[model samples]
Target: MNLHSAAPRSDDRDGYLVSRRQAWFAFAMTFALMLFDYIDRQVIVSLFPHLKAAWGLSDMQLGSLVSIISIVVAAGGLPVALMADRVSRVKSIFVMATVWSLATISCMFARNFGQLFAARAIVGLGETGYGSVGGALIASLFPKRLRTTLLGAFFAAASLGSVLGVMLGGVVAAHWGWKAAFGVVGVPGLLLAFLYLLVPDYKTVELAPRVGHARHSVRSFARQIVSTLAGSPTVWWTCLGAALQLVVVSMIWSWLPSYFHRYHGAASDHAGMLAAVIVLCGAVGSVIWGVIADRLAVRRPRNKLVMMAILCTATLLVFVTAFGCTMSANLQFLLIALGGFLMMCTVAPTATVVLNVIHPGVRSTGAAILALFQNLFGLAVGPFVGGLLSDAFGLQVALAVMPAFGLFAALCFLLATRTYESELAKVEHIRLDVATSSTSPMTVSA
Candidate 1:
């Protein structure tokens, strides 16, 4: 339990643990795996029409396929991340990728909706700790100053993967069948998982400094975690805000294809391509906004939270106008794309904030808490809620209402900003317990 062996062995003086080459190599491999992770998960979106045409499923049933993954991921993220913190992040990730990839491939063979649903749940189990673990690895591999931007870029892979998944699902399904798309995307992960094993691991860091105990015990471990989490109000608020914002993001990403098909009368394949454009903008927005947030905080760390709050407000406004107003389709599409960019502004920066204030030793575990919020309350809630609203009102009305959740997210970010500077001050004295060999996987969309 007192594994204080997670320090930078090779380059402690400069602050980053690994050499530049090693850092990039790790990033590339992790990024590739993350890309495929989403691809396998999301290829189902473009198949919505096919599945519906075949099964005569309702909107809720269709959305459940996406929501189920986030639900399982949220329920399971903490324990898995805790294990990764204590064991090997890299090995854990390898196994996770392999499991999810295999599960995705299994989706290709399911004969009924129930069977496919069960297979999809397995995919979520495989992805349980990936976002937090991956975030921990990248957070440790790079220098402290670059955390937000690099993490943003890393998460951008989710959108990119979703882009390909959606696009490929439509195109491939158009030529072949829906099952073929899953098989196409799932196989690459197996190769990537094997290659991921080559990435090294850092020693497990202790959760918190010991308090009055002479010997370590599970009681003490749980106690320390409670103490750490209870004291950091920033983590709680940030988690809430991140989860709320992701509600909007996930709704758009999950339903845009359906929206185009239902409203614009686009074919399934064409709808997917149109939706991919917005997702691609989100990928680009995440990185751009992350860099902007990082820059804003260069002088005052609290500025990062300030920027997040502003972005959330901007997203809320953009979406209300885009969806509520009756405009030409092309102009509405443009506004929706802009909203895509603004919507993801918080994805990377939220993780950066969590990493910034939390105890360095239990970074992965801390990140998993954030992941739980992002997955369960945000991404998990989005699609299902959208489906419900779509059924009750219509898809148009559902999309219009989703962005309003950003108001709550913004308030939480503002609340976080109040405590952000003070909490950051506390983390300043803390240092990582550097271990030369170590390993981990994480996010909203991850």
Candidate 2:
């Protein structure tokens, strides 16, 4: 038998993994689910007006419909990701898709604010681990050279899904009712869940650090999981910092339709269509920025953090100018769209940075930790806090001030630059042993 080195051959790395076709096929399924995942989460945004008009709800109550999902997702993400690392990623994903899709469908039948809130919470429960699990699986199957771009593309689905959700919700609600939007988006994910089963998965790999040893204890795994994240100050700073950046993103995405509707006197459908353009810009930016980050890292990987800091600073400047001062509607829209793109520059890079320093065996867990920070501190907080601020200060002032958080996010990313090289150097090199055949089981090449 040929001996496998710690540095794996580019052609045969990531263990005995899927064929090129199978990799893309699996990626397609994962990508589709991710798209629908955000669709369900964001469909509520366009419906905010409808909800408030119907229930006489406060801004916080309306924002709660969106924020609750992220809250529950934050609470549940870690445990679900731990299970995914041990079990099958594909299987876990299928179950999650089904649950969330069903929960989304149920939203159509909710008769009260409390009932709809509960359903939305269930939607979050289903989506809890999907991002971390999906990211881990995507990393494992694709060539390492392509992982960052592909990961960026994968996450861009969230933005695209948001676009679809915001648009579809408005158009559907205009014709039929707000409830019909849930059913329309919900059914496609269920169909995709069944289709996800056809995607092949890699078997779980143990850390087993000892030479010639094939397994490690669960206690060690738990300890390693903690160390994988806690030991890396870069990861620590990235999580908190990236999350702060997302507060700006989530706030803009969640409220743009409302912003346009109230300020420009646009109808719901018109406002949603307008907001979709901005989100589409962000979706495109996520992929492009990932490529930019990757190329900049060719000479020095830590420059990725430097790029993120610059992007955050740029976002702050653009938004402060766009919303902080009165400008023509056309000019403000242009700048806000530009700011939208700048804010997402870190989305792909942050995931890349966190995954870079984590152990292969605990990558999903590491990502989950990042997700916890994002969902709990970033995604969950942005909308509700925006609502609180909107109620107190008005939407225009709230949005203007929100982008300033990106400045803090910039500081955090720069601080992470301090330890990035050291943290990256500390990661163990891994070689997986296995076959190209989809049917073959996985193994680590020692």
Candidate 3:
């Protein structure tokens, strides 16, 4: 295992891990892999309309498929994270990639809603592991100063994948049918799974001394979990804020294509094209935000989270006016693009906060738990509720509901400021107390 830190001291014998260039290279490679991951998952959204028509399904049934995948993935995150923490993270990611890729390809064989739903559920199961492991890897590879930027760039790949998946799924479905589209997009992922092995393995520094390290046990795990949670108010707040943020992010991702079709009277291809453009803008925004976030981190560690709150509030206002008002198609697209940018900003910042607060031993599990809540609240509920509201009220009315969600999210994030600061202070205070307690009494013996 390779260990890396931001600054190396003269006494440090293991200098291999401190190379920033190696870390950056790892970041780039992983970021590329992450793009395919996002593409593989999101291809479903664009394919949804085609699949619905092909299977002659209702909106609720389609929404159920999405809900099941998300809920299952959320439910599965913990176990996967446990495995990732206990085992090789790189190997875990490779396994997840392979499993999900196979599942994605299996969608081609589905002839009905039941079969298709099962495939998506399998995809979710595999993905649960991927996210936790990948996140932990990225966190370990980068230092605090660059953590947000690295994570942001890593997450920004999702936007690029989103654009390709949505656009390609649309175009492919139009020409070759949904099944073939799944086959075309899904097969490439299987190859990428093998490529995961090429990336270098890096782990966080283990503080325990060699040969005398404490062995892990259930009791220690319980203690670790409790301590980790109690120790980091920032982690919980980041989780909560991210959960609320996803309410809007999830709905938009799952249903935006449908929204464009409904409101703008767009055909499948045209709506997808526009949606791709909006997502592309979001990808660009994430990269820009990542750069800004890293720069801000030099001054304030929590600046990333602060950025999230600010962006969420700003986006909420923009969308509230755009969706609530009678706007033209052009104007609506512009507003959605703004909203997308802000929503995308949450991804990198949330990842950084979660990693920063947790211990390396349990980082994967912590990340997975975070993923679980974020998915449950954001992915599972957001789109499903959006569809339900749209069915009862209308599409526009359903979308209008998200501004309130944004406000709730912003509030959660703002409360996090105090919690995070207090928690950090407590950690420092404990360390100082321990240092003083250790050294002060020893002087008398000397």
lDDT comparison, 1 vs 3, better candidate = 1
Ranking by TM-score: 2, 1, 3
What tens-digit string does per-residue lDDT give for candidate 3 at 215-290? 6577866776677765676787788888888888777777778888877778887788888887888888878887
My TM-score estimates for the predictions, one after another, are 0.94, 0.94, 0.88
Instruction: Give the backbone clash total of model 1.
Output: 22
* TM-score winner between candidates 1 and 3: 1
Per-model RMSD to reference = 4.3, 2.7, 7.6
| Rank ordering of all candidates by lDDT, starting from the highest | 1, 2, 3
The list of candidate 2 runs beyond 4 A from truth reads: 1-16, 210-217, 433-446
Clashing pairs in 3: 3-17, 4-17
Backbone clash total, candidate 3: 2
Give the least accurate 10-residue stretch of model 2, judged by summed lDDT: 434-443
Of the candidates shown, which would achieve the greatest lDDT relative to the real structure? Answer: 1
